[model samples]
Target: MNFAFSLPLALAAALLDVTVGYPQAVYRAIGHPVTWMGAFVAALESRLNRPTLAFEVGRASGVFALALYLGAVGVVAGLVSSLAPSGVVGFAALALLASSLPAQQSLDRHVLAVARGLEQGGLAAGRSAVAKIVGRNPETLDEAGVARAALESLAENFSDGVVAPLFWIALGGVTGGALYKAVNTADSMIGHKTERFLAFGWAAARLDDLVNLPASRLAALWLIAAAAVTPDASAREAWLTVARDAGRHRSPNAGWPEAAIAGALGLKLAGPRVYGDRLVDDAFMGAGRREADAADIIRALKLYRASCVIQALALAGAALIAQA
Candidate 1:
Protein backbone atom coordinates (compact mmCIF):
# COMPACT_ATOMS: atom_id res chain seq x y z
CA MET A 1 0.00 0.00 0.00
CA ASN A 2 1.13 3.59 -0.64
CA PHE A 3 2.05 5.17 2.68
CA ALA A 4 0.84 8.63 1.71
CA PHE A 5 -2.57 7.39 0.58
CA SER A 6 -3.07 5.00 3.49
CA LEU A 7 -2.16 7.56 6.16
CA PRO A 8 -5.11 9.81 5.35
CA LEU A 9 -7.23 6.79 4.56
CA ALA A 10 -6.72 5.53 8.09
CA LEU A 11 -7.53 8.93 9.56
CA ALA A 12 -10.64 9.24 7.44
CA ALA A 13 -11.82 5.78 8.42
CA ALA A 14 -11.37 6.53 12.12
CA LEU A 15 -13.32 9.75 11.78
CA LEU A 16 -16.04 8.01 9.83
CA ASP A 17 -16.39 5.24 12.43
CA VAL A 18 -16.68 7.76 15.23
CA THR A 19 -19.23 9.70 13.23
CA VAL A 20 -21.49 7.04 11.66
CA GLY A 21 -20.15 3.58 12.55
CA TYR A 22 -21.31 0.47 10.72
CA PRO A 23 -24.99 0.82 10.21
CA GLN A 24 -27.27 -1.99 11.24
CA ALA A 25 -29.06 -1.76 7.91
CA VAL A 26 -25.87 -2.41 6.03
CA TYR A 27 -24.99 -5.18 8.48
CA ARG A 28 -28.36 -6.83 7.91
CA ALA A 29 -28.05 -6.49 4.19
CA ILE A 30 -24.56 -7.92 3.62
CA GLY A 31 -23.45 -8.92 7.11
CA HIS A 32 -20.24 -7.55 8.62
CA PRO A 33 -16.84 -8.75 7.49
CA VAL A 34 -15.99 -9.94 11.00
CA THR A 35 -19.10 -12.12 11.06
CA TRP A 36 -18.18 -13.52 7.70
CA MET A 37 -14.76 -14.46 9.08
CA GLY A 38 -16.39 -15.99 12.14
CA ALA A 39 -18.60 -18.19 9.95
CA PHE A 40 -15.58 -19.41 8.01
CA VAL A 41 -13.61 -20.10 11.19
CA ALA A 42 -16.53 -21.95 12.73
CA ALA A 43 -16.91 -24.09 9.62
CA LEU A 44 -13.21 -24.89 9.57
CA GLU A 45 -13.15 -25.71 13.28
CA SER A 46 -16.11 -28.04 12.98
CA ARG A 47 -14.52 -29.83 10.08
CA LEU A 48 -10.86 -29.89 11.18
CA ASN A 49 -10.99 -30.00 14.98
CA ARG A 50 -11.97 -33.65 15.15
CA PRO A 51 -11.67 -35.22 18.58
CA THR A 52 -10.17 -38.31 16.96
CA LEU A 53 -7.39 -36.36 15.29
CA ALA A 54 -3.94 -36.30 16.87
CA PHE A 55 -2.93 -33.07 18.57
CA GLU A 56 -0.17 -32.27 16.09
CA VAL A 57 -2.48 -32.86 13.17
CA GLY A 58 -5.10 -30.56 14.63
CA ARG A 59 -2.47 -27.91 15.20
CA ALA A 60 -1.15 -28.14 11.67
CA SER A 61 -4.65 -27.99 10.27
CA GLY A 62 -5.38 -24.89 12.36
CA VAL A 63 -2.30 -23.12 11.05
CA PHE A 64 -3.30 -23.89 7.48
CA ALA A 65 -6.90 -22.83 8.11
CA LEU A 66 -5.84 -19.46 9.48
CA ALA A 67 -3.41 -18.91 6.64
CA LEU A 68 -6.19 -19.59 4.17
CA TYR A 69 -8.53 -17.16 5.96
CA LEU A 70 -5.94 -14.40 6.07
CA GLY A 71 -4.98 -14.87 2.45
CA ALA A 72 -8.59 -14.66 1.30
CA VAL A 73 -9.32 -11.49 3.31
CA GLY A 74 -6.10 -9.83 2.17
CA VAL A 75 -6.77 -10.61 -1.48
CA VAL A 76 -10.26 -9.17 -1.38
CA ALA A 77 -9.15 -6.00 0.37
CA GLY A 78 -6.24 -5.62 -2.02
CA LEU A 79 -8.64 -5.87 -4.90
CA VAL A 80 -10.82 -3.16 -3.42
CA SER A 81 -7.84 -0.85 -2.99
CA SER A 82 -6.34 -1.64 -6.39
CA LEU A 83 -9.55 -1.22 -8.30
CA ALA A 84 -10.20 2.27 -6.99
CA PRO A 85 -8.64 5.40 -8.51
CA SER A 86 -5.66 6.68 -6.53
CA GLY A 87 -7.37 10.03 -6.07
CA VAL A 88 -9.84 11.68 -3.73
CA VAL A 89 -12.56 9.28 -4.82
CA GLY A 90 -10.32 6.28 -4.19
CA PHE A 91 -9.34 7.50 -0.75
CA ALA A 92 -12.96 8.07 0.17
CA ALA A 93 -13.93 4.65 -1.10
CA LEU A 94 -11.17 2.94 0.83
CA ALA A 95 -11.95 4.92 3.94
CA LEU A 96 -15.59 3.89 3.74
CA LEU A 97 -14.61 0.24 3.50
CA ALA A 98 -12.17 0.59 6.35
CA SER A 99 -14.80 2.19 8.57
CA SER A 100 -16.70 -1.12 8.82
CA LEU A 101 -13.76 -2.84 10.48
CA PRO A 102 -13.49 -0.60 13.56
CA ALA A 103 -15.93 -0.94 16.47
CA GLN A 104 -15.92 2.40 18.33
CA GLN A 105 -19.64 3.12 18.11
CA SER A 106 -20.66 -0.51 18.27
CA LEU A 107 -18.62 -1.10 21.42
CA ASP A 108 -19.97 2.00 23.11
CA ARG A 109 -23.53 1.08 22.27
CA HIS A 110 -23.24 -2.43 23.70
CA VAL A 111 -21.50 -1.26 26.88
CA LEU A 112 -24.07 1.47 27.35
CA ALA A 113 -26.87 -1.09 27.21
CA VAL A 114 -25.31 -2.95 30.10
CA ALA A 115 -25.05 0.22 32.14
CA ARG A 116 -28.63 1.09 31.36
CA GLY A 117 -29.76 -2.40 32.26
CA LEU A 118 -27.98 -2.22 35.59
CA GLU A 119 -29.47 1.15 36.37
CA GLN A 120 -33.02 0.27 35.38
CA GLY A 121 -33.44 -3.38 36.29
CA GLY A 122 -30.57 -4.30 38.60
CA LEU A 123 -28.47 -7.48 38.42
CA ALA A 124 -30.71 -9.63 36.28
CA ALA A 125 -31.14 -6.92 33.69
CA GLY A 126 -27.44 -6.09 33.76
CA ARG A 127 -26.53 -9.75 33.39
CA SER A 128 -28.77 -10.07 30.35
CA ALA A 129 -27.23 -7.03 28.72
CA VAL A 130 -23.65 -7.78 29.69
CA ALA A 131 -24.01 -11.34 28.39
CA LYS A 132 -24.16 -9.91 24.89
CA ILE A 133 -20.61 -8.53 25.19
CA VAL A 134 -18.68 -10.96 27.42
CA GLY A 135 -17.85 -14.63 27.05
CA ARG A 136 -18.11 -15.39 30.76
CA ASN A 137 -20.96 -17.24 32.36
CA PRO A 138 -23.26 -14.42 33.39
CA GLU A 139 -25.87 -16.62 35.07
CA THR A 140 -24.18 -16.24 38.46
CA LEU A 141 -22.89 -12.69 38.20
CA ASP A 142 -24.02 -10.07 40.69
CA GLU A 143 -24.53 -6.43 39.87
CA ALA A 144 -20.88 -5.60 40.42
CA GLY A 145 -19.69 -8.64 38.50
CA VAL A 146 -21.88 -7.73 35.56
CA ALA A 147 -20.64 -4.16 35.61
CA ARG A 148 -17.00 -5.25 35.85
CA ALA A 149 -17.48 -7.56 32.88
CA ALA A 150 -18.85 -4.69 30.84
CA LEU A 151 -15.95 -2.39 31.74
CA GLU A 152 -13.34 -5.03 31.02
CA SER A 153 -14.94 -5.91 27.72
CA LEU A 154 -15.01 -2.21 26.83
CA ALA A 155 -11.30 -1.81 27.50
CA GLU A 156 -10.16 -5.00 25.79
CA ASN A 157 -12.35 -4.48 22.77
CA PHE A 158 -11.08 -0.91 22.56
CA SER A 159 -7.67 -2.36 21.86
CA ASP A 160 -8.65 -5.18 19.53
CA GLY A 161 -11.59 -3.56 17.80
CA VAL A 162 -10.31 0.00 17.46
CA VAL A 163 -6.60 0.68 17.91
CA ALA A 164 -5.40 -2.55 16.31
CA PRO A 165 -7.28 -1.91 13.12
CA LEU A 166 -6.12 1.72 13.00
CA PHE A 167 -2.54 0.59 13.52
CA TRP A 168 -2.72 -1.93 10.69
CA ILE A 169 -4.55 0.40 8.31
CA ALA A 170 -1.89 3.04 8.79
CA LEU A 171 0.80 0.48 8.01
CA GLY A 172 -0.92 -1.71 5.39
CA GLY A 173 -4.16 0.01 4.38
CA VAL A 174 -7.54 -1.75 4.13
CA THR A 175 -5.94 -5.14 3.53
CA GLY A 176 -3.93 -4.89 6.72
CA GLY A 177 -6.96 -3.89 8.75
CA ALA A 178 -9.11 -6.71 7.35
CA LEU A 179 -6.37 -9.26 7.94
CA TYR A 180 -6.11 -8.23 11.57
CA LYS A 181 -9.85 -8.59 11.97
CA ALA A 182 -9.74 -12.05 10.40
CA VAL A 183 -7.04 -13.18 12.80
CA ASN A 184 -8.86 -11.68 15.76
CA THR A 185 -12.07 -13.38 14.72
CA ALA A 186 -10.28 -16.69 14.53
CA ASP A 187 -8.76 -16.20 17.96
CA SER A 188 -12.07 -15.36 19.54
CA MET A 189 -13.74 -18.33 17.91
CA ILE A 190 -11.11 -21.02 18.44
CA GLY A 191 -8.23 -19.69 20.54
CA HIS A 192 -9.18 -21.40 23.76
CA LYS A 193 -7.19 -23.77 25.97
CA THR A 194 -10.18 -26.05 26.25
CA GLU A 195 -10.16 -29.67 25.18
CA ARG A 196 -11.81 -28.76 21.91
CA PHE A 197 -9.57 -25.94 20.78
CA LEU A 198 -6.23 -26.25 22.61
CA ALA A 199 -4.39 -27.63 19.62
CA PHE A 200 -6.47 -26.22 16.83
CA GLY A 201 -6.26 -22.60 17.95
CA TRP A 202 -2.59 -22.30 18.82
CA ALA A 203 -1.60 -20.45 15.69
CA ALA A 204 -4.52 -18.05 15.77
CA ALA A 205 -3.94 -17.17 19.41
CA ARG A 206 -0.21 -16.58 18.93
CA LEU A 207 -0.51 -14.53 15.76
CA ASP A 208 -3.28 -12.40 17.26
CA ASP A 209 -1.02 -11.62 20.21
CA LEU A 210 1.90 -10.72 17.97
CA VAL A 211 -0.15 -8.39 15.78
CA ASN A 212 -1.83 -6.70 18.77
CA LEU A 213 1.37 -5.98 20.74
CA PRO A 214 1.99 -2.48 19.42
CA ALA A 215 -1.67 -1.49 19.47
CA SER A 216 -2.15 -2.71 23.03
CA ARG A 217 0.78 -0.65 24.28
CA LEU A 218 -0.44 2.35 22.34
CA ALA A 219 -3.87 1.76 23.89
CA ALA A 220 -2.29 2.00 27.33
CA LEU A 221 -0.67 5.30 26.42
CA TRP A 222 -3.95 6.65 25.05
CA LEU A 223 -5.75 5.57 28.24
CA ILE A 224 -3.15 7.34 30.39
CA ALA A 225 -3.49 10.54 28.39
CA ALA A 226 -7.28 10.28 28.43
CA ALA A 227 -7.20 9.78 32.19
CA ALA A 228 -5.44 13.09 32.61
CA VAL A 229 -8.53 14.83 31.26
CA THR A 230 -11.42 12.58 32.26
CA PRO A 231 -13.06 13.20 35.61
CA ASP A 232 -12.43 10.58 38.32
CA ALA A 233 -9.75 8.99 36.18
CA SER A 234 -6.13 9.11 37.34
CA ALA A 235 -3.32 9.31 34.82
CA ARG A 236 -0.79 8.25 37.47
CA GLU A 237 -2.92 5.31 38.49
CA ALA A 238 -3.29 4.24 34.88
CA TRP A 239 0.47 4.24 34.37
CA LEU A 240 1.16 2.48 37.67
CA THR A 241 -1.48 -0.19 37.17
CA VAL A 242 -0.32 -0.92 33.65
CA ALA A 243 3.28 -1.22 34.80
CA ARG A 244 2.37 -3.38 37.75
CA ASP A 245 -0.53 -5.49 36.53
CA ALA A 246 -0.52 -5.63 32.74
CA GLY A 247 1.73 -8.66 32.79
CA ARG A 248 -0.55 -10.36 35.28
CA HIS A 249 -3.42 -11.14 32.88
CA ARG A 250 -3.42 -14.38 30.92
CA SER A 251 -3.14 -12.68 27.56
CA PRO A 252 0.13 -11.05 26.54
CA ASN A 253 -1.72 -8.07 25.04
CA ALA A 254 -5.23 -7.71 26.56
CA GLY A 255 -3.87 -6.81 29.98
CA TRP A 256 -2.49 -3.43 28.95
CA PRO A 257 -5.81 -1.81 28.10
CA GLU A 258 -7.72 -3.65 30.85
CA ALA A 259 -5.21 -2.54 33.49
CA ALA A 260 -5.21 0.99 32.16
CA ILE A 261 -9.00 1.16 32.40
CA ALA A 262 -8.98 -0.40 35.84
CA GLY A 263 -6.52 2.18 37.21
CA ALA A 264 -7.99 5.16 35.39
CA LEU A 265 -11.44 4.47 36.80
CA GLY A 266 -10.26 3.34 40.24
CA LEU A 267 -11.87 -0.06 39.94
CA LYS A 268 -10.33 -3.50 40.07
CA LEU A 269 -10.90 -5.85 37.12
CA ALA A 270 -10.04 -9.33 35.78
CA GLY A 271 -9.98 -11.36 38.91
CA PRO A 272 -11.02 -15.05 38.90
CA ARG A 273 -13.81 -15.51 36.39
CA VAL A 274 -15.93 -18.33 35.01
CA TYR A 275 -16.00 -19.25 31.36
CA GLY A 276 -18.42 -22.12 30.77
CA ASP A 277 -17.62 -24.85 33.30
CA ARG A 278 -13.99 -23.89 33.87
CA LEU A 279 -12.78 -21.14 36.17
CA VAL A 280 -9.89 -18.80 35.35
CA ASP A 281 -7.87 -17.57 38.32
CA ASP A 282 -6.69 -14.35 36.80
CA ALA A 283 -4.86 -11.73 38.85
CA PHE A 284 -6.52 -8.50 39.83
CA MET A 285 -5.56 -5.53 37.66
CA GLY A 286 -5.96 -2.54 40.01
CA ALA A 287 -5.80 -1.86 43.72
CA GLY A 288 -9.08 -0.05 43.92
CA ARG A 289 -12.68 -0.91 44.76
CA ARG A 290 -13.75 -4.33 43.56
CA GLU A 291 -17.39 -3.54 43.38
CA ALA A 292 -18.05 -1.88 40.05
CA ASP A 293 -21.42 -0.29 39.35
CA ALA A 294 -23.21 1.35 36.46
CA ALA A 295 -21.49 4.62 37.29
CA ASP A 296 -18.11 2.99 36.81
CA ILE A 297 -19.18 1.65 33.43
CA ILE A 298 -20.15 5.19 32.42
CA ARG A 299 -16.77 6.46 33.59
CA ALA A 300 -14.99 3.78 31.58
CA LEU A 301 -16.96 4.82 28.53
CA LYS A 302 -15.81 8.40 29.09
CA LEU A 303 -12.21 7.27 29.17
CA TYR A 304 -12.75 5.14 26.06
CA ARG A 305 -14.14 8.10 24.13
CA ALA A 306 -11.28 10.26 25.25
CA SER A 307 -8.80 7.63 24.15
CA CYS A 308 -10.44 7.48 20.71
CA VAL A 309 -10.06 11.24 20.40
CA ILE A 310 -6.37 10.93 21.19
CA GLN A 311 -5.94 8.22 18.55
CA ALA A 312 -7.79 10.29 15.97
CA LEU A 313 -5.73 13.43 16.62
CA ALA A 314 -2.48 11.49 16.42
CA LEU A 315 -3.49 9.78 13.17
CA ALA A 316 -4.72 13.05 11.67
CA GLY A 317 -1.45 14.74 12.58
CA ALA A 318 0.49 11.95 10.97
CA ALA A 319 -1.61 12.26 7.85
CA LEU A 320 -0.95 16.01 7.72
CA ILE A 321 2.76 15.44 8.17
CA ALA A 322 2.80 12.92 5.31
CA GLN A 323 1.02 15.41 3.04
CA ALA A 324 3.53 18.12 3.93
Candidate 2:
Protein backbone atom coordinates (compact mmCIF):
# COMPACT_ATOMS: atom_id res chain seq x y z
CA MET A 1 0.00 0.00 0.00
CA ASN A 2 1.12 3.54 -0.73
CA PHE A 3 0.43 6.80 1.10
CA ALA A 4 -2.76 7.51 -0.82
CA PHE A 5 -4.59 4.57 0.72
CA SER A 6 -2.36 3.96 3.70
CA LEU A 7 -2.80 7.44 5.19
CA PRO A 8 -6.53 6.99 5.75
CA LEU A 9 -5.93 3.45 6.90
CA ALA A 10 -3.53 4.72 9.54
CA LEU A 11 -5.91 7.51 10.50
CA ALA A 12 -8.70 5.01 10.98
CA ALA A 13 -6.48 2.75 13.04
CA ALA A 14 -5.40 5.61 15.28
CA LEU A 15 -8.99 6.67 15.79
CA LEU A 16 -10.06 3.16 16.70
CA ASP A 17 -7.20 2.71 19.14
CA VAL A 18 -7.93 6.01 20.83
CA THR A 19 -11.69 5.51 21.03
CA VAL A 20 -11.84 1.78 21.68
CA GLY A 21 -8.55 0.42 22.91
CA TYR A 22 -7.82 -3.27 22.86
CA PRO A 23 -10.24 -4.73 25.38
CA GLN A 24 -8.79 -6.43 28.43
CA ALA A 25 -10.93 -9.48 27.71
CA VAL A 26 -9.50 -9.65 24.22
CA TYR A 27 -5.97 -9.17 25.49
CA ARG A 28 -6.42 -11.95 28.05
CA ALA A 29 -7.84 -14.26 25.42
CA ILE A 30 -5.35 -13.75 22.56
CA GLY A 31 -2.55 -11.68 24.05
CA HIS A 32 -1.18 -8.68 22.17
CA PRO A 33 0.73 -8.39 18.91
CA VAL A 34 3.74 -7.36 20.94
CA THR A 35 3.39 -10.41 23.20
CA TRP A 36 3.09 -12.71 20.23
CA MET A 37 6.21 -11.18 18.81
CA GLY A 38 7.87 -11.51 22.20
CA ALA A 39 7.26 -15.24 22.25
CA PHE A 40 8.98 -15.58 18.90
CA VAL A 41 11.85 -13.41 20.07
CA ALA A 42 12.28 -15.54 23.20
CA ALA A 43 12.28 -18.77 21.23
CA LEU A 44 14.82 -17.46 18.76
CA GLU A 45 17.04 -16.06 21.47
CA SER A 46 16.86 -19.30 23.40
CA ARG A 47 17.78 -21.34 20.37
CA LEU A 48 20.17 -19.15 18.41
CA ASN A 49 21.74 -17.09 21.18
CA ARG A 50 23.60 -19.94 22.77
CA PRO A 51 26.09 -18.98 25.43
CA THR A 52 28.85 -21.04 23.86
CA LEU A 53 28.92 -19.05 20.64
CA ALA A 54 31.81 -16.67 20.02
CA PHE A 55 31.08 -12.93 19.92
CA GLU A 56 31.17 -12.72 16.13
CA VAL A 57 29.13 -15.91 15.81
CA GLY A 58 26.59 -14.69 18.31
CA ARG A 59 26.33 -11.37 16.51
CA ALA A 60 25.73 -13.16 13.23
CA SER A 61 23.13 -15.33 14.91
CA GLY A 62 21.45 -12.15 16.16
CA VAL A 63 21.28 -10.75 12.66
CA PHE A 64 19.77 -13.98 11.39
CA ALA A 65 17.30 -14.10 14.29
CA LEU A 66 16.18 -10.56 13.58
CA ALA A 67 15.67 -11.43 9.92
CA LEU A 68 13.63 -14.49 10.83
CA TYR A 69 11.46 -12.59 13.30
CA LEU A 70 10.71 -9.69 10.94
CA GLY A 71 10.10 -12.06 8.04
CA ALA A 72 7.60 -14.11 10.07
CA VAL A 73 5.81 -10.99 11.29
CA GLY A 74 5.53 -9.61 7.75
CA VAL A 75 4.12 -12.86 6.36
CA VAL A 76 1.58 -13.25 9.15
CA ALA A 77 0.45 -9.66 8.89
CA GLY A 78 0.16 -9.96 5.10
CA LEU A 79 -1.95 -13.08 5.40
CA VAL A 80 -4.17 -11.47 7.97
CA SER A 81 -4.47 -8.29 5.89
CA SER A 82 -5.55 -10.43 2.93
CA LEU A 83 -8.40 -12.04 4.84
CA ALA A 84 -10.32 -8.77 4.80
CA PRO A 85 -12.99 -8.44 2.09
CA SER A 86 -12.40 -5.91 -0.68
CA GLY A 87 -13.61 -2.29 -0.46
CA VAL A 88 -14.68 -0.32 2.60
CA VAL A 89 -15.52 -3.39 4.66
CA GLY A 90 -12.02 -4.70 4.13
CA PHE A 91 -10.52 -1.36 5.06
CA ALA A 92 -12.51 -1.26 8.31
CA ALA A 93 -11.50 -4.82 9.16
CA LEU A 94 -7.84 -4.09 8.45
CA ALA A 95 -8.05 -0.90 10.47
CA LEU A 96 -9.42 -2.86 13.39
CA LEU A 97 -6.42 -5.14 13.38
CA ALA A 98 -4.01 -2.30 12.81
CA SER A 99 -5.54 -0.43 15.75
CA SER A 100 -3.85 -2.88 18.06
CA LEU A 101 -0.48 -1.69 16.83
CA PRO A 102 -0.73 1.73 18.48
CA ALA A 103 -1.11 2.08 22.27
CA GLN A 104 -2.35 5.65 22.72
CA GLN A 105 -5.21 4.78 25.05
CA SER A 106 -3.32 2.11 26.91
CA LEU A 107 -0.33 4.35 27.44
CA ASP A 108 -2.60 7.06 28.73
CA ARG A 109 -4.25 4.63 31.10
CA HIS A 110 -0.95 3.34 32.43
CA VAL A 111 0.55 6.78 32.97
CA LEU A 112 -2.64 8.08 34.49
CA ALA A 113 -2.57 5.17 36.87
CA VAL A 114 0.80 6.40 38.10
CA ALA A 115 -0.60 9.86 38.71
CA ARG A 116 -3.52 8.41 40.62
CA GLY A 117 -1.21 6.20 42.60
CA LEU A 118 0.81 9.21 43.62
CA GLU A 119 -2.17 11.37 44.48
CA GLN A 120 -4.13 8.69 46.34
CA GLY A 121 -1.60 6.26 47.75
CA GLY A 122 1.55 8.34 48.09
CA LEU A 123 5.10 7.23 47.17
CA ALA A 124 4.71 3.49 47.61
CA ALA A 125 1.63 3.38 45.45
CA GLY A 126 3.31 5.57 42.91
CA ARG A 127 6.27 3.21 42.84
CA SER A 128 4.02 0.21 42.30
CA ALA A 129 2.18 1.86 39.46
CA VAL A 130 5.29 3.22 37.80
CA ALA A 131 7.04 -0.13 38.15
CA LYS A 132 4.50 -1.71 35.85
CA ILE A 133 5.60 0.58 33.02
CA VAL A 134 9.23 1.39 33.81
CA GLY A 135 12.24 -0.91 34.01
CA ARG A 136 13.88 0.95 36.85
CA ASN A 137 13.91 -0.33 40.40
CA PRO A 138 10.81 1.13 41.95
CA GLU A 139 12.20 0.95 45.45
CA THR A 140 14.95 3.37 44.52
CA LEU A 141 12.45 6.05 43.69
CA ASP A 142 10.86 8.63 45.87
CA GLU A 143 7.62 10.32 44.79
CA ALA A 144 9.45 12.74 42.53
CA GLY A 145 11.53 10.00 40.99
CA VAL A 146 8.45 7.92 40.30
CA ALA A 147 6.72 10.86 38.67
CA ARG A 148 9.75 11.66 36.55
CA ALA A 149 10.09 8.06 35.46
CA ALA A 150 6.45 7.93 34.45
CA LEU A 151 6.77 11.11 32.39
CA GLU A 152 9.96 9.84 30.77
CA SER A 153 8.20 6.60 29.86
CA LEU A 154 5.27 8.61 28.51
CA ALA A 155 7.45 10.62 26.16
CA GLU A 156 9.58 7.69 25.01
CA ASN A 157 6.61 5.41 24.43
CA PHE A 158 4.77 8.17 22.57
CA SER A 159 7.44 7.71 19.93
CA ASP A 160 7.71 3.93 20.02
CA GLY A 161 4.22 2.71 20.88
CA VAL A 162 2.13 5.30 19.04
CA VAL A 163 3.99 7.19 16.33
CA ALA A 164 6.24 4.40 15.08
CA PRO A 165 3.44 2.02 14.13
CA LEU A 166 1.30 4.71 12.48
CA PHE A 167 4.31 5.94 10.53
CA TRP A 168 5.04 2.44 9.22
CA ILE A 169 1.38 1.66 8.46
CA ALA A 170 1.13 4.91 6.52
CA LEU A 171 4.08 3.74 4.45
CA GLY A 172 3.62 -0.03 4.03
CA GLY A 173 0.26 -1.02 5.54
CA VAL A 174 -0.33 -3.15 8.63
CA THR A 175 2.49 -5.48 7.63
CA GLY A 176 5.02 -2.71 8.00
CA GLY A 177 3.57 -1.72 11.38
CA ALA A 178 3.74 -5.31 12.57
CA LEU A 179 7.33 -5.58 11.39
CA TYR A 180 8.25 -2.44 13.29
CA LYS A 181 6.55 -3.78 16.43
CA ALA A 182 8.44 -7.05 16.10
CA VAL A 183 11.78 -5.28 15.85
CA ASN A 184 10.84 -3.14 18.85
CA THR A 185 9.87 -6.21 20.87
CA ALA A 186 13.11 -7.94 19.93
CA ASP A 187 15.06 -4.95 21.09
CA SER A 188 13.23 -4.83 24.40
CA MET A 189 13.69 -8.52 25.12
CA ILE A 190 17.21 -9.20 23.92
CA GLY A 191 18.72 -5.91 22.92
CA HIS A 192 20.96 -5.05 25.81
CA LYS A 193 24.55 -4.42 26.75
CA THR A 194 24.63 -7.40 29.10
CA GLU A 195 27.16 -10.12 28.46
CA ARG A 196 24.54 -12.47 27.07
CA PHE A 197 22.95 -9.90 24.77
CA LEU A 198 25.72 -7.45 23.87
CA ALA A 199 26.55 -9.31 20.68
CA PHE A 200 23.38 -11.27 20.08
CA GLY A 201 21.14 -8.21 20.31
CA TRP A 202 23.31 -5.76 18.41
CA ALA A 203 21.40 -6.05 15.16
CA ALA A 204 17.97 -5.71 16.73
CA ALA A 205 19.04 -2.68 18.78
CA ARG A 206 20.68 -0.98 15.84
CA LEU A 207 17.76 -1.63 13.52
CA ASP A 208 15.28 -0.48 16.13
CA ASP A 209 17.20 2.76 16.32
CA LEU A 210 17.26 3.10 12.55
CA VAL A 211 13.56 2.35 11.97
CA ASN A 212 12.53 4.68 14.80
CA LEU A 213 14.43 7.65 13.46
CA PRO A 214 11.62 9.33 11.54
CA ALA A 215 8.92 8.58 14.06
CA SER A 216 11.07 9.82 16.92
CA ARG A 217 11.57 13.15 15.24
CA LEU A 218 7.92 13.34 14.28
CA ALA A 219 6.81 12.52 17.81
CA ALA A 220 8.92 15.40 19.05
CA LEU A 221 7.31 17.76 16.58
CA TRP A 222 3.88 16.51 17.59
CA LEU A 223 4.72 17.32 21.21
CA ILE A 224 6.06 20.70 20.21
CA ALA A 225 2.80 21.48 18.46
CA ALA A 226 0.85 20.16 21.41
CA ALA A 227 2.78 22.45 23.69
CA ALA A 228 2.03 25.41 21.49
CA VAL A 229 -1.67 24.89 22.00
CA THR A 230 -1.55 23.77 25.62
CA PRO A 231 -2.29 26.54 28.13
CA ASP A 232 0.56 25.96 30.56
CA ALA A 233 3.10 24.37 28.24
CA SER A 234 5.88 26.22 26.47
CA ALA A 235 6.33 25.33 22.84
CA ARG A 236 9.41 27.49 22.58
CA GLU A 237 11.02 25.61 25.43
CA ALA A 238 10.11 22.32 23.81
CA TRP A 239 11.83 23.32 20.60
CA LEU A 240 14.85 24.65 22.46
CA THR A 241 15.20 21.45 24.51
CA VAL A 242 14.99 19.26 21.45
CA ALA A 243 17.64 21.32 19.74
CA ARG A 244 20.05 21.47 22.67
CA ASP A 245 19.60 18.30 24.71
CA ALA A 246 17.96 15.69 22.50
CA GLY A 247 21.36 14.64 21.20
CA ARG A 248 22.82 14.45 24.71
CA HIS A 249 20.95 11.31 25.76
CA ARG A 250 22.61 7.93 25.30
CA SER A 251 19.71 6.62 23.26
CA PRO A 252 19.75 7.59 19.59
CA ASN A 253 15.96 8.13 19.36
CA ALA A 254 14.28 8.35 22.77
CA GLY A 255 15.79 11.72 23.56
CA TRP A 256 13.73 13.50 20.94
CA PRO A 257 10.27 13.23 22.52
CA GLU A 258 11.62 13.17 26.05
CA ALA A 259 13.44 16.43 25.60
CA ALA A 260 10.50 18.13 23.94
CA ILE A 261 7.94 17.11 26.53
CA ALA A 262 10.28 17.64 29.44
CA GLY A 263 10.97 21.19 28.37
CA ALA A 264 7.36 21.85 27.51
CA LEU A 265 6.30 20.63 30.93
CA GLY A 266 9.17 22.34 32.71
CA LEU A 267 10.79 19.22 34.10
CA LYS A 268 14.08 17.35 33.91
CA LEU A 269 14.14 13.77 32.64
CA ALA A 270 16.55 10.97 31.65
CA GLY A 271 19.20 11.99 34.12
CA PRO A 272 21.30 9.39 35.94
CA ARG A 273 18.99 6.59 37.01
CA VAL A 274 19.05 2.97 38.10
CA TYR A 275 17.57 0.09 36.15
CA GLY A 276 17.66 -3.11 38.12
CA ASP A 277 21.12 -3.18 39.69
CA ARG A 278 22.83 -0.88 37.21
CA LEU A 279 23.08 2.86 37.60
CA VAL A 280 23.09 4.23 34.06
CA ASP A 281 24.68 7.67 33.97
CA ASP A 282 22.79 9.36 31.19
CA ALA A 283 22.55 13.04 30.37
CA PHE A 284 19.47 15.01 31.31
CA MET A 285 16.96 15.81 28.58
CA GLY A 286 15.77 19.25 29.82
CA ALA A 287 17.17 21.86 32.17
CA GLY A 288 13.86 22.04 33.97
CA ARG A 289 13.03 21.15 37.57
CA ARG A 290 13.88 17.72 38.91
CA GLU A 291 11.39 17.62 41.76
CA ALA A 292 8.23 16.88 39.80
CA ASP A 293 5.04 15.51 41.37
CA ALA A 294 1.59 14.20 40.49
CA ALA A 295 0.51 17.56 39.10
CA ASP A 296 3.40 17.49 36.68
CA ILE A 297 2.41 14.01 35.56
CA ILE A 298 -1.05 15.39 34.86
CA ARG A 299 0.51 18.18 32.80
CA ALA A 300 2.53 15.68 30.83
CA LEU A 301 -0.60 13.65 30.21
CA LYS A 302 -2.33 16.77 28.88
CA LEU A 303 0.50 17.20 26.42
CA TYR A 304 0.30 13.53 25.46
CA ARG A 305 -3.40 13.79 24.78
CA ALA A 306 -2.88 16.93 22.75
CA SER A 307 -0.13 15.25 20.76
CA CYS A 308 -2.44 12.34 19.94
CA VAL A 309 -5.00 14.82 18.66
CA ILE A 310 -2.32 16.45 16.55
CA GLN A 311 -1.31 13.10 15.11
CA ALA A 312 -4.87 12.27 14.10
CA LEU A 313 -5.29 15.65 12.43
CA ALA A 314 -2.01 15.25 10.58
CA LEU A 315 -3.13 11.86 9.31
CA ALA A 316 -6.46 13.24 8.19
CA GLY A 317 -4.84 16.23 6.46
CA ALA A 318 -2.29 14.04 4.70
CA ALA A 319 -4.98 11.63 3.53
CA LEU A 320 -7.05 14.53 2.18
CA ILE A 321 -4.08 15.86 0.29
CA ALA A 322 -3.29 12.40 -1.02
CA GLN A 323 -6.86 11.98 -2.26
CA ALA A 324 -6.84 15.39 -3.92
- Note each model's CA RMSD in angstroms: 1.1, 0.9
Task: Provide the overall lDDT of each model, using Cα atoms, as 2-decimal numbers.
Answer: 0.91, 0.94
Per-residue C-alpha lDDT of model 1 across residues 109-218, encoded as one tens digit per residue? 99999999999998889999999999999997989999999998998999999999999999999999999899889999998888888888999999999999999999
> lDDT per residue, candidate 2, 229-268, as tens digits?
9989999999999999999999989999999998998888
After aligning candidate 2 to the native by TM-score, how far in Å is the CA of 29 from where it should be? 1.8
> What are the runs in model 2 whose C-alpha is more than 4 Å off?
none
Q: Give the lDDT of residue 32 in candidate 2.
A: 87
- What's the distance in Å from true for residue 50, model 1? 2.0
